[model samples]
Target: PTAPVAAAAAALCVLAVSPGQAWAASADGPDGPAAYETAEGAKPVKGTAGSGDGPEISPGTYTDSIGRGEKKYYHVDLDAKSSAFISAVAAPEPGSRVKGVGEGLKIRLETVDGSECDGGTEPQFSAEGAAYPVADYATRLIGADDECQKAGAYLFSVEREGPETSDPGRWPLELRYMSEPGLKGGPRLLPGSPDSDEEPGDDETPAPVTSGEKRQAHGGTGFNDAGALAKGVWRDRIKPGETRFYRVPVDWGQRLNASVELGSANSPGEYPPTIYDGFGITAYNPARGRFEDDPFVSYTPDESAQAAVYTPTVDYTSRFDYSTNTPCLAGWHYLAVTVSPQLGKFFKSTAPLTLRVDVTGTAKAGPKYAGDAHAAGFGVSDEDKEQAEKGQNAAEGERSDSLRIVAYVGIGAGVVLILGLAVWTLTARRRAEALPGAPGTPGALGGPAGPGGQAGPDGGSGTV
Candidate 1:
């Protein structure tokens, strides 16, 4: 998963945001108004500049390992003073000018195995651990963490506080960026499709596993539910004994065919499978709506065999989706989900119903997609595959509790053995007191317990 990423060559030229011509009286000039933190999204600051963990450039857009792949992230921050009410700052496109207008300000990332890899939520760098903005990074700061595997470019968009009244040029951001891998992508999806893309859940099977160096993680899912978002919607419903497939939308970045394991099992061994993408159905608020057009694509990385298990409810559930990370080449045609054998059979309805179509790009209007029908990757040995699955299944439902149980059982058995040894020692002492004196009790206590748990102390007792 070591993808070679290209830096702008010049750090200053990387961002294409334009300095606006308009500004409030006090918030005028290129070095306009000092920012203020209203009790909003990302607290706005009144000043810029400080010292803190700086932003880092990642190696690749994605990576892989163990039960999963594409396991890296990035960390960036800045020490600056501002005067506008800054909500959460957006990660914009590579060189977009209009920032903070909710346009081009999206933080999108995915995994190598097509799981929705996430960045740290509410992770920060500032003067204090408390949620406070850095007045300046030359001394104080503001920051967030991104995934850190292979290299990739991150785009951020900006938005100033207020009801679209003041110009953004009035606020100055003294940003400092840094890179850290110890952060997190949090927890992501299982390998296979478990529900309608509308309502993703845990009761599904685990995806395939990984080998070589396995990474240890301690983060949870950061399902971005901020702003106006629709949590549930119906994707595709499978009737009894019916099966449907999907095509991954990689935008042609894939070398081979892409595929997602789809099913409708009540549990792992259950049957009547179905996989569908309901990403198009989910809605977002205006502030975060610009990214709504980006279809969730599975970013598959190089890995051995792996599978995800989960339960699919009638509602939709979304998994390994899209990412604006640099790994996604602009204009490449990626595949989404396609119903195989035949589109969903309507046991309840016969006439073909038109499904609403959309695209990650605003220009193109096409059928909503998910993953591909073909499997792609380096095959895994059966033995290694099994171990990886054990981890994946546990991870999907947040079931590390089972691992805890196993550890306690081992400890319990060890305690039992120790107690048994103590009991045996005491029994031998009592026997000696009762009648086993060396001279008089020779026949009575010749052996306590031999290898076979028989006879006396010295060895097995016999007529001798």
Candidate 2:
């Protein structure tokens, strides 16, 4: 906050180009949006029924290792009549001791070619934890006119922002594909996806790409430190200090918006009333790389699961946090921040918090073109998942000067486009009017000319 800072935050924005949007409760699961809102006056309303029963998933269930410093992705290829959705239903290996808020899991989307999200128009990756932990946020994608034809992919990664560890557990998570609204998964694992005729016929479904290949080491988190320790929330006591660290995998230089819930209590004596809670400010960047001292402020929660909200437009180094100031007491709260949606449906299921981060102020601004954020590796990856875990930035960070530079460029571009259109329209009208035997009227354009003004047959001088 000392100097101006860059601003960034991903959000659950409806990218519909048609009239009227319809929001619905996911029959796929019981929990969704409104239930996860952490902000005041911004909570979402209940949802009703929806259209399109899920088509059979081709590669039904799959799994990966997600090494210490790696990001693992999977694809759900849709046939003419079938479609698929990717959701994280279980924790990635219990060894990481991951738990609490937005700590252990991040989901993303990507393209088969591995480029160009932002035009995302499919199901995003969503999360559902076993210990009643919120996905923190999930994304909902409005329908696309060309949906059944396009393909979708999902990215799953390990995040250790709460309790820390490097072990990728071996628990068998169940990821299934339902063909219709009323269908349920079998008692044991099905062979391949319902979409695939090849029934592997068992609980064992290995990912297409095997593990121990590249061995990219990274950190991960889960709902219970059940495997690593007994703790299950964000705390510094285990590690101590006002500063904390967390890391998530990305394609490099991508936008990441993040937030955390906080709470704390009193000790036997007054040793400054021990501070324990979520952070408000944090510093991070790719150069220093993942798994380092994060750019977040020290925090102490006033309650647990009491429901607190934090809307952070966090940057690579900025942070976002909940409050503990009496009236602003913080305890077991919920924080939701979208990392990036440049990739597409990668975030459709996260059921993210409601506020939209206007990266316009602190973001890179863009080419000032009419397109949404589909730049190289910049937007939330809808290309497949854009993980759409898309790293999250703190919403509490201050604005930076780079924001203004982008504004000026946008204004200048707008002026140029207006001028260009004016010229083109004028030229086209003149050419139409100058046609042989065309009308000599001043306004010989697409509409009717003025009274007393002459009009040629067929409305133009160039009559067929």
Candidate 3:
């Protein structure tokens, strides 16, 4: 074979073998801990972040459903190189029989010196009817130029707001707290809420998908124990201001897309005049960190009589860059859905939010860094890390072995074919040269019989 043909065959073979290695690399890449892994190990801590006696907390999910009208505080310690993310998901407002004014609960993050971290007072209401829950979240980096940037104890408060009521039922709170590595010992900018900026406008509304009769129950109620789902559409429920957290495992090079489908109101009409359906959805990376300067607003305008969907493509995490601001690394990414309250005296019955998650592209692992497997703010356990490393090594070895066998067989077959073709060509040439009437050879018609040399039917020279 010519050099060009040989090179072409080699290129084809490389292309054929590349996919298997790439796939194996993704399936066995550096596996991080599952989402909400810390939820199971979180210890119960009660009381407030003040009074010099608040219970200390760490990276985990905690719950509170008892003790009505009592203020609860939890304290988290921060290092000089870390930032904190705190979220509170409150249970739906309970239905009351007695008539009373609407009341609310106050949640705030503060330092010991009385500095507010993030978020303001959010109201809670109870009446003669049923109401849904509420979900509020906040994030603060422990550095300069921000409130409570010092490396010390910080407070997370949940207290009663508005007028006191006779309802004795306590609110079930799903609390999530995590401390991630800060950037250069400085406070980074936080993304503004889409809900705050949305107004009643004439922008084109996306058509939402309707839920089918067949549905699956979500794994858990809150972000801490978020249910695991494969790519496709899923049907689930969320009350007023209630939030549900779900996680999808995306490989290093995969693209993740998620959207929420809220039930529409009565008929094909506009949203209720008095009701403002507020819903928002956002996603976080495996390290529970968001991409920097990349405005990620999955869904806005929280409510619609028709279905609402927000699907955005996520950039694959890179292996080279370790900056917390950039979206890098792989593992279980988080999707949070928040449903705001409706202040009108109306009850609209409709299907639950149909969450559609589509993951495309081949899985390729991001950069592998030694040390903390969960350095990107993930709670990866030592066992999970060990298992991932072992599995990766085994899979890679298997792939290598299989590829070696295939490569050997392919190369051998290719060489044999080339040699057979070369021999056949040589034999054909020799046979032609040995022909009886071949040119420049001694044969029956070797010399011209006539003036012009020409071969006759009797194998003798004839006159032209």
* C-alpha RMSD values across all candidates: 24.7, 23.3, 15.0
- Report the lDDT tens digits of candidate 1 across residue range 1-464: 01111121122222222111111122322221112212223222222111122134222111111010111233322212110011132211111122122321112233233333243122121111111111111001111122323333322222222223222223223222222111122122112322222222333333222222322211111111111101111133322111122111221211111112233222223342332221111111111111112222221112111122111221111212323211111121111221121122312321111111122111222112232211111111232233223322212322334444544565565456556656777887777667745534544445344445555665556443
Please give the distance, in angstroms, between residue 104's alpha carbon in candidate 3 and its true position after superposition: 5.1
Q: What is the lDDT of residue 458 in candidate 2?
A: 38
The parts of candidate 2 lying over 4 Å away from their true place are: 1-65, 73-75, 79-84, 89-106, 115-266, 278-305, 309-464
Q: Model 2, range 145-229, lDDT digits (tens) per residue?
A: 2223343442222222333442344322333222211112421221221122223222122222222222211111221101110
Report, for all candidates in order, the number of backbone clashes. 123, 90, 14
Per-residue error at 413 for model 3, in Å? Answer: 36
In model 3, which regions exceed 4 Å deviation? 1-41, 65-70, 92-105, 118-130, 142-144, 165-167, 183-219, 235-245, 249-353, 358-464
Ordering by TM-score: 3, 2, 1
lDDT of 3 by residue, 203-235 (tens): 233333234443453533344456665555677
Candidate 3 lands at a TM-score of 0.46
Of the pair 2 and 3, which is ahead by TM-score?
Answer: 3
Worst 10 residues of 3 by lDDT: 29-38
Better of 1 and 3 by lDDT: 3
Q: Flag regions of model 1 displaced more than 4 Å.
A: 1-257, 260-398, 401-409, 412-464
